[model samples]
Target: MDTSDILKKVRRIEIKTRGLTNHVFAGEYHSAFKGRGMSFSEVREYQFGDDVRAIDWNVTARFNHPFIKVFEEERELTVMLLVDVSESSSFGTQKQRKRDLITELCAVLAFSAINNNDKVGVVFFSDGLEKYIPPKKGKSHILFIIRELLSYKPKKKGTNITETLRFFNNAAKKRSIVFVLSDFLSDSYQDALNIAAKRHDVVGMHVYDPRDKELPAVGLIQVKDAETGLQQWIDTNDKQVRDYYNQQFSQHAQYCRNAFLKSGAELISIRTDEDYVKALQTFFLNRT
Candidate 1:
């Protein structure tokens, strides 16, 4: 896209997502994702409800009065968005493509992070690591990220969630809130996911089209594999074919769910045609 087009798209996304961040998600996001831990702030005169263990004996000895140590939650975080840029993300039989939905979601998340004074970064992957934007704070940084998410092209066309998880685990040295946005179509990533979860707060956002879950009874149809560029003709009218297709999708979904559960991570499934704001708000409220 041209520079003018990119700027317009960024402005549109900012208007929509920034508004959500300010009016809807800012507080919820802060509550849902906690910081590292409590940090020492100061010591103040003991109150009736102060914890006995928090008493500062040295200060009390000097002042001849009970003083309690005060601590506050460390409220800054590093949020990483691990996005899948494989060709499959380019497919969506709805109002928008899967990639477009992913882009908007990423924008909202980035804006939310900035609103919380947290650093936000992104890792785009397609079979292999494609791009890594280091964690940074500020609106300009987030705008740059949104621009890249909208126009950057990937060097590969396949999905490799396992490798991507390993890459993220190594790259992000500190504990962070990691959001993996993808269709969950890859395999053999369970172990990697478990390892990542052990260190980081990992959440999976599964983005898929409704058609991915079932085959419509539209008679003969041709389909192409986006990643492999393979083509095939199938009889969608056949009950057996439709049943098999649905079964495959179900099995994959089950596996994805099980993997996240086993890893002690959360998963949010979203469709391209649905309202992502509601889904995100629901997830945050439930988490809180």
Candidate 2:
């Protein structure tokens, strides 16, 4: 895509996702994610229902009355989007491609973080680390991120999620809320995922298309693997072939879910044709 087209797409995504953030996700995001820790805010006269444990004995004695210490949640945070830009993301048989859905989701998440006064960054990966946008705050930075999401072309076509996770662990100095957005068609990253989760708050945003789950009864078809460039002809009309395809998809999805659970991370799966807003809201609420 050209500069003009990219800008337009970015603008469109900004408008839609910003609205979702402002109206729907702002409060949920706040509730779903906790601040780093508590910090002293102020001291005030003790109220009837105030927690007795918070009573400031020193202050009360100095002031000759009951007083209580106040603390507030430290709201500022750094959010990192670990997006997979492998060839598989380009496949989707729905209203939008998996790449486009991932783009919009990232935009929404970045906007939500900005609204909460958090810095946002991105890591684009395909078999290896393609690019890393340092965490920063501001509308312009987020817009630039959106633009990159729309037009980024990866140098490699395969996926190495393990390497990507390791890179993130080394790159991000401070703890952050990391969202790994991808179709997750690759495996053998469980160790890295667990290690990262122990350091940073990790969440998996699993994106997939309906066609990924089941094959249609279209008689015969030639399929090509996006990442490996493998091609084969399949008899889709055969029930056994279709069942096997679905079974494999299910097993892959189950593996992903188990990995995230073992790592003590949350996973939210969204389909390309589904309303991601609803899915996200449900996930956030469930987390709360």
Candidate 3:
């Protein structure tokens, strides 16, 4: 895309997602994700009902009076967005393409992290790792992320979620919150997901279009596999063919649900045409 067009798109997303982050998600985001641990703030005179274990023995002995250590949650966190730039995300027959919806979702999450004073980073992947933006805090970094989300193109078109998760595990040493946004059309990623979830807080966002679940009776149609670039003709008018297609879609959906469940991760499903804001709000509220 041209520089002017990219800037325009970034500005548009910033205006929409920033407002939602400020108004709808600020509190929910804060409550859903926790800090590293409690850090000592100061020591003060012991108050009634204060925990006895919090007493500062040194300060108490020095002052010849009881004092308690005050501590607060260390609220800084690193949020990683493992985004799938596979070609499958380009398909959508709704208000926007699946890729566009994913971009907006990433923007909202990036803004929310920044609003909470947390570090935000992104790992863009397809069949392989495409780009890695190290975790950092600041509005400028977030804007750069949004800009990349809107304009970056992937070199490969296939999906390999395992590669993305493995890259994350090797690159990030500290515990972080990872949101894997993809259609999840690949297989053999269970082990990678299991390992990553044990190390980080992992959430899966499954993006799909309604047409993926069922096909319309539009007679024979030519279909193309977005990832593989294979084309074939299908008889959508035949009841048996339609039924088989629906069944396959359902099986894929079930696999995704079970994969997340087995890994002890959360899954949020969003349709391309639906209001993703409401879906995200519900997810955050449930976590909180």
Among all candidates shown, the one with the greatest TM-score? 2
Summarize candidate 3's per-residue lDDT along 1-288 as a digit string, tens digits. 899999999999999999999998979999999999999999999999999999999999999999999999899999999999999998999798889999999999999998999999999999999999999999999999988988898999999999899999999999999999998988789999999999999999999998888899999899999899899999999999999989988888899999999999999999999999999999999987
Q: For model 3, what is the C-alpha lDDT against the true structure?
A: 0.93
Each candidate's TM vs. the true structure?
0.97, 0.98, 0.96
Model 1 TM-score is 0.97
Give the CA lDDT, 0 to 100, for residue 145 in model 3: 93
lDDT of each candidate versus the true structure: 0.94, 0.94, 0.93
lDDT of 3 at 35: 97
Q: What would the per-residue lDDT of candidate 1 be over residues 23-123, giving only the tens digit for each residue?
A: 98979999999989999999999999879999999999999999999999999999999999999999989899999999999999999999999999999
Tell how far residue 259 is off in model 3, in angstroms.
1.0
> Model 3: residues >4 Å from true position, as ranges?
none
- What pairs collide in candidate 3? none
Which portions of model 2 miss their true places by more than 4 Å?
none
